[model samples]
Target: MEVVVNRQDRRKRRLVRLFLRLLLISLVFAAACAVGLLSYTKMQGPPPLNVTQTTVYYGADQSIIGEHHQGENRHWLPISSIDTEVIEATLAVEDRKFYSHFGFDPTRIGAAVLANLKTGSKSQGASTITQQYARNLYLSHDKTWKRKWNELLYSLRLEMNYDKDQILEGYLNTVYYGHGAYGIEAAAQHYFGKTAEQLNLAEASMLAGIPKGPSYYSPLFDLERAKKRQGVVLQSMVATGYLNQIEADEAHLEELTFVQNELDQPSTIGPYFQDTVEKELIQTIGIDQALFEAGGLKIYTTLDPQMQKEAEKWVASEMPDSELQTALVAIDPRTGDVKALVGGKDYTESPYNRATEAKRQPGSSFKPFLYYAALENGYTAATTLLSEETTFTIDEGRGSWSPSNFNDNYADDFITLLQATAFSDNIYAVKTHLLLGTDKLVEVAERVGVESKLKNHPSLALGTSGVSPFEMARAYSAFANGGKRVEPRLIRKIVDSEGEVLFEAEPEMTQVLDPKLAFIMTDLMTGMFDPYLNAHTSVTGGSVSHLVSRPIAGKSGSTSSDSWMVGFTPQLVTSVWVGYDKGNLQKPAEGQIAKRIWAQFTEGALKGQLKKEFPVPAGVVGVKMNPENGLLATEDCPTHRVSYFVEGTEPTKPCPPPAADGQPETEVIDEATKEKENLINRLFRWLGN
Candidate 1:
């Protein structure tokens, strides 16, 4: 019996020795791992604390214009900026041993581990403020072992690198409160309509209790529950020696005025413009969407607040309150910076940004592109095409397309290019389009910053291609800027939260057009406002000409469903479009509204600005010519006007001496001659096809 008992004791002692040896090995392995992790973390330096802060957008003058966040309205505040009561309450509830412990409280952790084991779940948490902040910054709040292990390493690294105050401040700044509020500063503002520094003891305690379960403890979510949480916080503060019993009781009894209605959010000056900036940052500028939303970027945009207000104001007042939607965009001709933009009459009802998204046929507004091509292809402002009813041959003469002038009106005679453009003579424009191959116009459109896809259709000259107002403005900016490529830019610079410049815009320009040809086209566009250029039809811009107090060059275009007015000066380019959504037919009465809005906005936006003229480039000469014929003006001509021309393109001959009769001689076309001319035009059309 004694020998059997000795054997049992010996077996028990051996089992105990084996357990001790294994435990010692495990301790050594864990210590080595901890030391290696610490060394690695130390070499890595401090972890970034700028997690998920609110991105602020500023206008040209550096005034706040907009803000964005990743569903959490986080705003960072220093520990000094935070209220004393808030810190005390947070420390009392979150980590009483915060200053004394390294990064975690082992006593509380041991107790929590036992409790979690008993519950068979991670229902009990003992994270100190430092550990919580580390998790908030780097790891997700999953109760899994992997996340917890990562949290432990991160927390240790933080404690080694930063002081206690830094961890506390970072925690206060990044901890999430409810209702889209992420930090204590945002929380104080959200709940009390005051800043974190202005928080009273009552408000501080209320805010400090929110991090436990933001949705459940938010006063906005439930006042009674929040008050109970606040009471617990006050009692904890008292127990932690941060508050006396009397003070705690007084704070608990104090009546707090929660913000009734959300503090009137400062209205963003231009919502559509803001959206475009965000888009350019992500899509065109190649910024990651996650970083753009959560990186706390300081976006400095080119928007002029006053100009934006005027744009919205004029659009609202001038636009008739109907289902007809409108889009307006204004840009600086020189810098290519978008100054103001309105996507639609109401953004809430529809977030579709028509300024940048809607692709409507620009109608006659597209003629400028064709005209520019003509100038490039040996056609001058003095060039003439017979404006008569004509049918054009297409596809090797397999089909015919007949184009008519507005109101079926026609000069039925030779008219100068200036007159053709001023009158918007469709017959003349079509003849010119076919004369210059369709590819020329498409090439010109692309070079001048029209990004929309253009097809080589004969009707493209009459503005059959769909383009957005934003593209139209950019295209016209080249003309206004003397032939330099103008890429629309909304954000001038972007900075990260740490004051590092993420991106900065440099004024880049490529000479895309002959400076002389661009200047001449700009000069020709002004003919739309000149009554002297009127022949069969009124000048396209004549209705709004009287509204111009300065030398403003502009054009108006209309399709069955869309209306557009694009205009510019040396300083600014503005484009306005009015139309029904989804291409519904627009009423004739609404046609003039686009012009009115353009004129009013242009005049308003440039009201106090200097009147600048388009600088005529070298190698161009001005000559007085007969408005009726593209000939040097003589004493017999009824009207004379100065026309700018490339030095050699001016007509060498004066108008033919007046006939024996006092009136000028008119070309008399006999029937045979007319038929022969018609056959010749058809032959050219066939050849072009």
Candidate 2:
């Protein structure tokens, strides 16, 4: 009887142990359920607010003008609002059991585990759509056990609180597709230039494949790789019953006709312009992180796309082969808006924006500033300077310094300042620089928009000073805008994602020179094309006559290695520079290529535009003068002798008398007489005429 009792006691103890084990298991299950419910409740606590969207505007002709961004920190759109095909394809490829699962699929988990075990590596993911949404929204994409557990719990909570459609909607709207694109709406517009509604099955499939690895499957990088990934997506859709085999086959066979419409269009304005606008936006409005990161902004630019296209095409086709790089900048002088810019040949080849970033010797381009300085310091077109032999020596601490003209043929002759400028005579310019003083020239250049560093020396007169194309354009604008300097700007306004105006560019104009002085300079520059003034040389006509269809003014500059042409109409200013990236001296023929480009672009851009000359304000007047003497001309003066002047500054007196000393002077006579004398001199002296 005692042995039987002991057996019964042992049986009771075993039964007790089994009961405790079952109770502990039930408690654990209950705790898990409570945790999951709490998590789900937290996730569904509040609906997200929609962020503001920004739109860009173009020019008066519908060219991109600038961009506007509005909103707070998030650029958010509901997933259900997006196209159905994109969602269908994404689910078909990313999570097949998304709809039927509660939060996670045990069968899929088991299958993934078995697959991983068989492959000896972890490659399969068993996350349902709800899980993926939870992971993207709440968890980092770090592949770790703890994070995975958290993701699983979050998925359960999301599924419990939201419907399958809601989960998917949130997921699609929040996922990252790389290239700075966030959400399907931004991705759709960025990659295909089409909205979600317009995406075709092939495009949907292509986008669906991107989330696996956007950079790897980007169509821009490798179309074949993208197509292959797309094929896999299509196959998956068929297998999972999202698509029938017939549909899948059709999709696979479909040639991807990605209409690169956005890229083909002149979508973005001048990069330098855009950069300037961005800087201002940051300074004035302060950057909205959310809009900047996720909002798809449509920026309207002040650029005329047609003109910008022509400028780019001309530069690319006409720049010399030896010149591996070149830069061009165009601005609306009246508004100080940048219209077009070419920073370099290819962005991928080099991202160093030469237009605004490079500071190089400006060569003869610097002469314009010197001339302007001379005008400001009481020098006039009629001012006489001895262009005869002259020299200057400076102590360089160790040795004496001297400079000479390119030809070293300095005749001791008096020439009008206007004549010297029209010819771009180096010796004359240097002598004038010495007389005017380097400090005064620096002051004029700075006021006129030369932002780069200037070296105080005689070479400054010859454009030995360094400056950028952007600065040159701005400086030239003073002439175009009648001596008013308008600071160059790219962006007109900045809006947040919510369409709040955070910043706007207020156009600023400052008078850099007296109106009369500017007119005098323009008139003098215009005479550069005068056949009489530029006789015996093959210099291109003045900027005005070169664009004879309209009025314009400009200067050409060539350093030992760099060639530049900066010009402007009343409405626009453009500067072009051509040279080796390494600063090697280019041949003259190479330099001409840049000029041809400028001519071609200007010709095409100005086509069909009204022919308008730079308006000479009421105080300015036309005058007649001898090309050789720059003195008042009688009624018998040639038609080529016409010039412009401030009303009070016009030449009113005859030229001064020649010196008493018997000095040999270059005689100015009629062309017929000059030709006869030249022939006789050539025969007698046996020297080339």
Candidate 3:
């Protein structure tokens, strides 16, 4: 009996010890698995806070010109940059146990579950700050079990990899406020019209209450509701020991000034220019589209706000009341930085950026490119082409083409390159184009940064090819910038949210033309404004010549459907196009509107600027010559001006003195005999008197 009792006791003790060992092994395995999972999660670096922020565009003067964002207007700031009051208010309202908890608050979660279960609804929320941030970044704000499970996993990953302050900073930057604002910084700017650092305690409490229910609690939406929510935020702050009850009461009583509603915010300045900058940033600068989506970029552009205003003002004031639409672009000649741009009459009504996008026939405004080719091929300002009505026989397949001047007017005799350019003579231009093979003009256009595909034809010299005002401005910049080809630039530099430099323009320059040829070409362009070059017709720019307060080199051009005035000073280059949206013939009076707009815009934009003239290069020489015959000036010559040429290109022959009579041989100033004398003749006659 004793043996049986002892055996039973021993067997029972063995069974008990085996059960204890099994339970201990299970507990140890579970602990080891948990440790391994935590280590693996920590190895994965901090999850990306994919926060969308606002991108601000600054003008040349460092003034805010525009802003861009996706759905949210957000600006990220470091935790240290954020005010303490904002942090305290947010933490008090969001998660008081943020620093103590690993990722979520179990106590609060239990209480919320109990409340929801009892109410038979899922309205209660127990998401900690980390959990909310994780949801904002990688998950959606749905109350489904799957979304909550994913949010919990993301929160653990973030908390394990990043510090408490880092998670808090990310949360503060990504949390959405009302009125298209996300993050405290953007909310501060939108509501208070001040920076995050400038927010007072009252403003901080008021802003903190917005994220609870942005539509209901936004001060801009409802003052009474906002005040009530702010009181709740203040009470929470006092309970969390961040503020005393007395301080909370004082803040609740403080008067807060909210900014005008976001709907009432004025449209950004230089919308067309801003659009161009964005395009250049993406296309020309090769910025990643994703970077723009993630926003928080500072793009420093070359826009001149004052000049932009001047351009808009003049385009609005001078544009004809007809259906004539216009586009204007101004660029710094030396740097190729676009200073001002006006795409249309009203950007709100029409956002078509004609200055940078619309391509139209530039008429004689494109003559400079043709003349540039001529200059390179040893043609000087003194070179002559007969400006008479004539037909040119082409190859047998294409047949013959005839060119006519404006209003069927002609010089009849030989006209110097200076005179032909001033008169915009179509007959002389075609002759010059044929003289230089069509390929040479195309080559010159490409070398000078004209990106448009030009059709190689005789009429191309007469400006039949279609190109944008931007392309025209870029092409002319080479002439204005001492023959250096400059890529037109809108953005000067770009910085990312982390202060990383994404792009900085270095002002690309290539010497595409002989400095001497460029100078001579520029001088020839000036002839359009000079009355001395007038002969059969008025200089094309004569109508606006009186508006010239300084030496301006320019050209006026017109096709049946398009009108253009592209001109430049030493400091600036501007291209203005006036026309209908569709191809419609312009009225005769409409043809002159481009010149008026150009003149007014240039005069107004350059109001306080120095009056600069194109500088002559070292290899070029200025020689006084007969404007009609392209010969050296003689004592009896009635009209003469300084024509610039390469050292060897100046004419050797002198004008014959008076054809052996007191009456001059050539009709230099024939105002008395010519019945069709225009403004140029009147000015020259006035000067002769």
Whole-model Cα lDDT of every candidate shown, in order: 0.85, 0.70, 0.85
lDDT, candidate 3, 188-265, per-residue tens = 988888988888899999999899898888888789999999999999999999999999999999998877676426
Candidate 3: Cα lDDT at 354 = 95
Off by over 4 Å in 1: 1-50, 77-98, 101-161, 176-179, 184-267, 632-638, 651-662, 667-689
lDDT of 2 by residue, 14-108 (tens): 99998898888889888898777776656665333243443455553664444444422123456645777788899888887777777788898
* Alpha carbon lDDT at 212, candidate 3: 80
A best-first ranking of the candidates according to their lDDT comes to 1, 3, 2
Distance from true location, Cα of 671 in model 1, Å: 13
* lDDT for residue 411 in candidate 3, whole number 0-100: 77
Count of backbone collisions within predicted model 2: 31
TM-score per candidate, chains pooled: 0.75, 0.72, 0.85
Pairing residues by index, what is the TM-score of model 1?
0.75
Strongest candidate by TM-score: 3
Which lDDT value does model 3 have at 192? 89
For model 2, what is the alpha-carbon lDDT of residue 33? Answer: 84
Tens-place lDDT per residue, model 1, 1-689, is: 99999999999999999989888888988889878888887887888765878888899989878888767778787799899989999999999999999898889989999999998999899999999999889988899888887887788889989999999999998898877778898788778878899999999998889899988997776889999999999999999999999999999889899874453254559999998888889888999987876757889999999899988887888788778999999999788899999999988888799999999999999998898887776676667667788889987789999988888898877788888878888887787778777888899999998988987899898899899999999989888888998877798899987678989997677789888888999998899989877766789898888886888887788888999999998989999999999766556779988998888888888888998888989988888888667788877664767888887666666887787877667676663364345446434532342
Looking at model 2, residue 246 earns an lDDT score of 90
- lDDT measured at residue 344 in model 2 versus the true structure, 0 to 100: 79
